[model samples]
Target: MNSTKGSMINEKKGRIGCVKWHGDLMDTRTFSNAGQDLYVRVNETILAQYAKSSGSLTKKAKLAISIVSVLLFFLVVFLVYWLAKRKSKGKERPDKFVSRVLTGSTYFEKSTADLDDENTINSSELPFFNLSTIYVATNNFSASNKLGTGGFGSVYKGVFSNGKEIAVKRLSKHSGQGIEEFKNEVVLIAKLQHRNLVRILGCCVQDEEKMLIYEYVPNKSLDYFIFNETNRALLDWTRRIFRGDQNEANTNRVVGTYGYMSPEYAMEGLFSVKSDVYSFGILLLEIISGRKNTGYYNETYPDSNLVGHVWNLWGEDNALKIVDSSLVDSFHFNQVARCIQIALLCVQEDPTERPTMSAVLVMLSNDAALPQPGKPPFLVKKSGTIEDNSINYVTCTIVSTR
Candidate 1:
């Protein structure tokens, strides 16, 4: 009974004890009190043999587990690297997009990364106009159909078989503005719904052909009438005289037409909504007086520009003297005088003195006291040349990567 109690105590303590059956001997393994192996068998000789053989077997099993763990760790790392590489390799390049546009596909299919169901089409919308259609429309770009040239390229008028009038400004092969202007006009005009500005209907970029399509203004640009004496007379309310200057390089120094450029813009290249205001001022004066801002000449008043001359007349309260005699017959003196004041204010040398388009529109629509304008720019000298007042003519060019 005492041995049975000792064995029960050893079992509870997890001491290894062997149960020897009649045929096969089964060993029950447990830890010793000191945490060493506790082996119990029939004899000491059996225990010694078992301990020696199990040592090498246990070491081999541990080695197999370590090898499997290392292999699994390496396999996981390799899979992660391969997945990252695949993701990076799938990224689309800009050149690839350009090539796609050049391929002449009728329908443009956007990449999954480029668009989705909630896709908002900005200027970068796929499926642009076909090059073949534009070529056929322009009569293979005949010289006779050419209208006017610009910084980017030449404008050609095209009449489609359906009698659709279209003007295509084909981008020059060497033009720097083609890509950027294409994107800018597309994005800007798409969102801006304005009446005064020329409307851009659509654009096309196919096989290196970048073109902008605008709603054709039948009267053409304001320059057509403002620059020529005969043409100026046409706009002078009936039959009256009007007069213009600038070189090509100086012309392109600023955006917009030559005679139409504000003195501030022509000299300083300072542009804003006010810049357009300055242009509109020049146009207004040309329309009223039938005289060009850049072309007026008089020996008596060597410093007489259209703006300066108008300012003198306004001060004398004889501003009506400058108004074309033909317009005098049918024109409202009150409206004409107010328009002259507004034009003079717009042409002021100081940009801060000019009003925004909204403000200008308001002032024109209502009777409001305008602030006195500062000195107008391009104060004409003895010669009919425009003088630049600003220092840095070449401003930094903004480039878009995408």
Candidate 2:
């Protein structure tokens, strides 16, 4: 009988635990629904006593507790905000990440759709370089050390005391470019370890001087070769033709020249990874023909640019006629034909039809069957003047004529 009574008391205690406060302070109600009703009854007495004590606490003490809780909440919020801001500010530019993606310096999205927020970069390790160090490296911008000029500014060759050769691209004050492009190039190229593309070592932003430092190419650009007859022979025997395709080889072997600029880049400047593919095609043609694209030839092929001449020879089933005489005996006819076809494909008027760099690599590497190229634009001879209808800077307007 005593054990039964103890069980009854325990059951009663559990029933009182279910009650919950509801409604406003002055008009509160207790909820008691189903299983929850059991606890409300079991814990009622204990809860009433606790409530009585809680109701009598001094308002000042209650206010103090509230203030402390609010302070604690804000402190946590502030800390999180501060940390996030610092992290975002710490992120590096996107170009570096692009380079990393390209060169396999880092493995990431294989396609455009795969890019996600998580693959962000941390900021540059060196925020900025001292102007004095840059001046010392460039020999205070000596004329003899000058490399070349671009839209952004003049590039100068620099050699550090440690035997590191560098190209310093110094931006002009009123140049149309911005810090963003420089940062983009730096972050992109630094991570990209491609043998074909140039490498960016570092950058310097001091007062008015915004300079980008790159690894020096001893022979400089491809323009040095394809633009003149004397220099064009360096590409003789089509050694440069084969050399340009080794995008995965030594960094020094990559070709970049002026007359060798791909039709897409020269016409539209709509560059992608394939822009280099197009460039390689032009360079290959220049090597084989020993001719420059922009140079004036006879009127029969007055529209006869280098690419057009090669195309004409290919159509007549006499592609060998275009090959330089210097390598007539040793040059592989099959290899030369395939290269010319690939070059023509790269210079196609329609950008959409152009093969990607990876595709070009495959075509060059294997015995894969290549596609027939469409007739290129500027195929016909024009009388008198030729107009460049390219877009203008700042306004970005395209000038069209009848």
Candidate 3:
């Protein structure tokens, strides 16, 4: 056998040969001369060149991977930084909005100035006057000028030095209205213009003090004349009672006289025409008995108000015994009892069972045997404090969650 090395091309050749190698990078060739024995050739120069080229390609692949990893790391850092910046801005937005409201115009007005016309805001008459202005106008909230107290706070009659009459409704310190809510109400009232709704003149907001100012229209509240004995005889209050209806809306903040609040509205913030029916029932009972429904105490029933006491009298067929002395001889016994039944119907625990104002009119106008009422909602002391028992019902609901 003849052996040649380092070159594939032999100076002399005759026969071809090939063999597999198990474990090394090898470039092999076979050769023969003049039909002699087979010859082998190994080219180390080509093998070295291939090895160097492979190493160079491997190094290039590693460098490319390292560059990609570094670029990805920087991208992650940039994304995190951007998200943090956005979150910080979000945290600042509410404070900025409130600052704008307190100092001058609200953020909404400023932001939407280009999009909305100045005349579109029905707030030209609504002055966001300072607390000092209201303080002076209200004579430091003297008790003598106070119109009446409400569920939220006391209302005072304010006469400006210029002889403008204004009503100042001072919000209680314990009231749960936050600045956000107060701001929203200010904006909403400013935009509303209606005769039925007393025109809101302005608001007063200062350190721990919030008061709503309304244009004073001289008229006593319905409760005033209804509960007053001397004034009760002047007008046929029963016929003048059923007034009007409105589309009911639910609110997070429930505000009304304690005695007048409905079960669903008082406890769960759910209100509808049924709520009006509940209030009307209270009024009806008051009118018939010439008594206020709120503070009336019954020695027979502990922690029970006018509703529970009336319910007891009603169940026992002694309903007329609970009537006002002034009304006792004036109206027929049957008529008074029937009115009690209608009031009970209005104060039913289930809103659906309560008669609408229209139905109430029919019942009052006719002597039809009225349908029986469900249990009326009342306050009872289970834990030493008067608490509402209306939440035990399975079906009571608010409009929806915020």
Candidate 4:
């Protein structure tokens, strides 16, 4: 081949090399690090050329061989250089502005020690998890790790190097929340301070990947047992709390609302984690203030149920008024305030917004940020308008009784 022809081929090879280099970085499903292994072949190829005798070769033939070999040598050398750089980068961690997304298919240990010195998080600011760390924690977000799927995304179970459990909420590509909106939500969620609410441990937003990290609620979201014959028998609302396992017996009776019954159970014979959360919320409020919700009616707030009265007080910044007067002087106001906010969260009208029993436990244990509670269910006012809440009812009755 002539020099012009040979040069064109090399140029073409260089362009191909460039594509392979960056293409792997951008779309990694097919990425493979075999460059180092191929580097030694260059030496072998060069040495083999000498073994071919030049006794029968003319001067022009010799020149052509040398030119071709030189071009090939440069091309491989440039490839090696590019590959080496990329290979080294595998060990590096991404910056605030992430650029790559990697996928791995390996996991057996519940969790392993693989991360950037503990997510490189400030430990005080909004935590940012490396995509790699999240993958390891959730076993690459395995299907088995999935707890449930919601409108916004899917939730998966995870564990850390210390065997600490966590929940990962991976948002879908079409979730409609862009990077900016997600960032804003993260910031707002971080500012909240409570235990019952979902605690944000960290988050990952790399390239097209977006996920939120939370402490795993082992017992699970809400109580689905008040309906189960066995569970219903095992627990009474007065003693047993919401543990969303399954079922509720006695489909033949009207177990009237104790004010602790969630709306869904009351109206639709439906129950879920959130529905039970509503029931728990009422119990929580009653316990904190030493007030009985079943017959709660104050002259100052005659038109409101216990849930609404507290919500109104909360809006008026006077929720502490609902605290048990007997213990007010002996308790920490901040702690009590946090509990009130958490109770409100549990009692939220929308079952979807209510925290699960596991979340309630987290709220009681961790110092996670708390969101402002919305109006509770069955909120009534002097104007005669009523705002209903998600409910699941449980009454003092029997499985075969009417």
Candidate 5:
């Protein structure tokens, strides 16, 4: 019994020794794991701080680039504007005379009304000639100095003291619509600047007297050459140029020459840009045929006018017969035919059927297919009695026989 007890005590001591060794191993493993965790946390904190610093630097760089780009863009725009302004200034030199005419005021701030007086004429930028100067230039309105007369007024040839030649249009006192016509001439001519249109040099308005000075057209009006048998030869190989205004002006009374007046204008007193076109068509026919529409009467077709005569000839395919005898062989056949077609198109009774001036120019320049023309407005035979309507027709009889 004593030997058995000693053996059990030895086994108990061995077991206790084993448990203490296992506990020591567990403590060592726990300490190693804790140290590893601490190192990982420290690395994570350092990485976060470095990333924040990098992000801040990137934002600053982007901001700097944006500011620089905007500055460069503004600088480029400013430079371009400055250069353009400088160039335009160099090209357009402001003329004092033109400026004064446009503004209706001189350098002295004197109004047109003030400048109208002969004493204050020096204040005008436009060459202002007093009544005395004009009188001396035109030889006191001598009959021999008269160049021509028109619906508006009579034109006189004037020679200045300095030997400058001028054509002066003296408004007639007998003309009831002279004031309105004078105003229209001044306003209209002053604004126009074209090679084909006559240039207005200056004007004179002194107590019941109004006159316009124009650059002398040596060849005279188109009608002078186109109408005259001897002068018509001079127009060979030369194109007749005519300018038409698109804007229409309404008048209370009809105030144009008899032959050139459109049917609508003559009868109803309704005039438009198309009316001018109609008149131009008549003029064109006159130019081509070398015959006046009103004055010329065909004994064969006693009732037929120039327009009717051309239309009939065109239908018969013998339109070339109507061409001026002098220009028949000289002028281009194709061009003359095209002009006749264009003229017929222009004189169509329906104004909308006619082509615009731009289209006419295009057709004149190119060989495009032209649209068929409708019936032209028939010219009324001048009987002693009025034909269409009972409307009072007051003829502005200042005829141009130049």
Candidate 6:
């Protein structure tokens, strides 16, 4: 019985050993699978992190490029502006340069007797009048002989020794025009020989004295008759008689009559033939309304100047109401209306919009359709200051009536 019991114990031990070996094999297989799964997960995580890093780098590079492009654009703009301003400053005025040349030479300082020599002064183009002759003719510039005054100087009625009627323009000592402007005027007027333009007879440039001799017109300037209440009646005849009629003087100084000056000339010191057209338009309006542009104040429309007042009246189809009261039944309505339209076209703020003188003459004579005018430069009065918003700061010179 002891032998049988020992054999059963051995058998039980063998079974236990077999069970332990099987269990060890199962654990080894599970551990190998778990390790493989862990490696796969780590690889996936590394790839994702790498992709994220690459995307962030691309965004940063794009942002940096955008900032650089913006900076370059502003830099180019600033450089261009600075260069243009420098160029403008470098340009010198022609008149100023001419003045320097004249004053720097001793030839201009010669006496009248020396200047009379044929080789001394160029008298072939324009007649050079003797200072003594002009003095006697103008009665030594007597105030009684004074016909009018202009931005240049005073005009005096002079009768030459030969009984020729002439008008003398005496340059003021403090006149805005320098010697160069005087020379320019002489040269410009000499070349032009239009009947409408004042004819130049001679000139005198002796020492500090400078004068111009012109053919005398029996009637005074158009302003004299047009501005006067009673004298305005004669304009109908005057207009019939003279339907056809006719500068950056210096950059350092502005040379023009106030109120009559064009916006380009008054504000930017720029002038052209178009500037003359602007003046003519203002004159036409003055003739039609019989009121000065500088001093016409309406109690009903206190804020409105002559241009603004006329524009308002024109827009409302009440243009005829702005006409001079003196006309009564004498003036033709169609003619007066046409004149107003032409005048408005001439006073356009943009110089290019204003018609040329030749074009103006055609408009006056013909019945061609006219373009509608845009808003004119309405002079605004602010805090005891006149603000012309269309332009930068300007210097104006008040001129005496001629």
- As for candidate 3, its clashing pairs are 14-32
Compute each candidate's TM-score over C-alphas: 0.54, 0.55, 0.52, 0.34, 0.59, 0.60
For candidate 4, which ten residues in a row score worst on lDDT?
Answer: 1-10
- Over 268-292, each residue of candidate 4 has an lDDT whose tens digit, in order, gives 7776668656756775676566555
How does candidate 6 score on lDDT?
0.62
> Number of clashing residue pairs in every model?
4, 25, 1, 25, 0, 0
- How far residue 5's Cα lies from its native spot in candidate 2, in Å, is 89
On lDDT, the stronger of 1 and 6 is: 6
lDDT of 6 by residue, 1-402 (tens): 011111111132234211121111122233532332111112355567888999999999999999999999999999999999889666633433334434433222213332224312344344567777788888988899998765567779988766678888787889654444466555455444444455566577765677777767665555566667786776673362253330011111222545667887777789798887887777678777878776656676677778778888898998988787777566888888899999899889999999998999899899989988767775542224333323322222211122
The digit string of per-residue lDDT tens for model 2 on 251-357 reads 12212233444456656666565655655566567666766665555456766667777778778888777776666666788887887888888777676788887
Residue by residue across 1-402, what tens digits does model 1's lDDT show?
A: 012111212344556564333444245445454444433334556656778899989999999999999999999999999999888666534334433433433222333242222222233434234566667778989999887876557788876555566777777888655555444444444434344344444456655577765544443444565456565545544222111121111111223445556556566566577876786677667667766665564456666777778777777778877786546566778878887888888888777888887887797789888776666766654453333322222211111111
Error of 4 at 151 (Å): 2.6
lDDT of 4 at 137: 85
lDDT of 6 at 47: 67
The segments of candidate 1 whose C-alpha lies over 4 angstroms from its true place after superposition are: 1-127, 174-196, 236-271, 301-304, 366-371, 381-402
Candidate 5: Cα lDDT at 29: 30
lDDT of 3 by residue, 100-123 (tens): 444554422312232113212233
lDDT of each: 0.57, 0.57, 0.61, 0.57, 0.62, 0.62
Candidate 2 positional error at 6, Å? 91
> In TM-score terms, which candidate is top?
6
- Model 1 vs. true fold: TM: 0.54
Task: Work out how many backbone clashes candidate 2 has.
Answer: 25
True lDDT of residue 71, candidate 1: 100
Per-residue lDDT over 117-195 for candidate 5, one digit per residue giving the tens place of the 0 to 100 score: 4422442434455777789889999999998776567889887765667788898899766766665554444444344
